[model samples]
Target: MINQSVNEGKTAAIISHFWIIGLIIAFIMNMSKKNYFSSFYIRQMIGLNALQFLNGWIVYKFLGGTAGWIVGVLLFVLWIISLFGAIKSEEKLVPVVGEQFQNWFKNF
Candidate 1:
């Protein structure tokens, strides 16, 4: 049972840890078969990354380095938690933002 989920989307799941690489792998995998966690995690990570980038840029431009560092740390923690959940086959989301990801990325 566990092995089946791993075998079904293990590549995508593992790839997702690599940031962009995992995302691409998930996209490709989705083309053929659907792995629930892999697809959700991929989209979640992409959205998170985009938000982080935008926040960092805006903060750096306006608030400077200190604010950016704070936001970056928070995002890092979220990423780690999300990765852990996906690896464990748990559908847990990263605190507040995770549930939204699940809902938003349901189609994939």
Candidate 2:
């Protein structure tokens, strides 16, 4: 069986969710091997970032700092779990949006 663990170059996937810099790193890493999770995870991270970006308008825009803090913390936790799973070579999805990401970006 193919080792499911993210390999040497695959580390990019786990780090992609940290911030935009991580996304750039992932992009560079994936430039040579497009089929790797490094690429797919980067795409997923971008999607997640976009979602969070839009979240500010939906909840934080009116609820203010308190709601933003709650939502931000929740997103951070999910990001950590997904990053850890990816690093450990597991295909576990990130709760509600995990499966959707995989399906939406299947072509990647």
Candidate 3:
């Protein structure tokens, strides 16, 4: 079952990690398939993009250069980790808010 999901959804899952455009593309690709694997990464991308927006608005605006940089790096690392897990056909959460993302975006 796991291997089958990876086979069917790998392309969409990888594309979903590339930010908004990729998220849209992956979503379209998964529309017919309704792939669990693709949906999982799509939810992750949604949350990550929200974090990106917050980083831009709140972190960069109020936190100053050093703190903003730190948070930015951390978010990037989380993205990389999640992307790598997708590549490896793994379904691990995206660190802190991953579970929340899954719960909140369950309808997707």
What clash count goes with each model?
A: 2, 1, 0
List pairs with backbone clashes in candidate 1.
15-22, 16-22
State, as a TM-score between 0 and 1, how close model 1 is to the true structure: 0.81
Q: What RMSD does each model have against the real structure?
A: 2.2, 2.3, 1.0
CA error at residue 107 for candidate 2, angstroms? 4.4
**Candidate 2 lDDT over residue span 8-34, tens digit each:** 546788778778888787777777766
For model 3, give the 10-residue run with minimal summed lDDT.
Answer: 63-72
lDDT of 3 by residue, 30-79 (tens): 99879999999999989999998899889989988788889889999999
How big is the RMSD of model 1?
2.2
Best by lDDT: 3
Which has the higher lDDT value, candidate number 1 or candidate number 2? 1
Local accuracy by lDDT, each model: 0.74, 0.73, 0.91
How well does each candidate superpose onto the true structure, as a TM-score?
A: 0.81, 0.79, 0.94
Candidate 2: worst-modelled 10 consecutive residues by lDDT: 1-10
Error of 3 at 5 (Å): 2.0
Candidate 3 lDDT (Cα, 0 to 1): 0.91
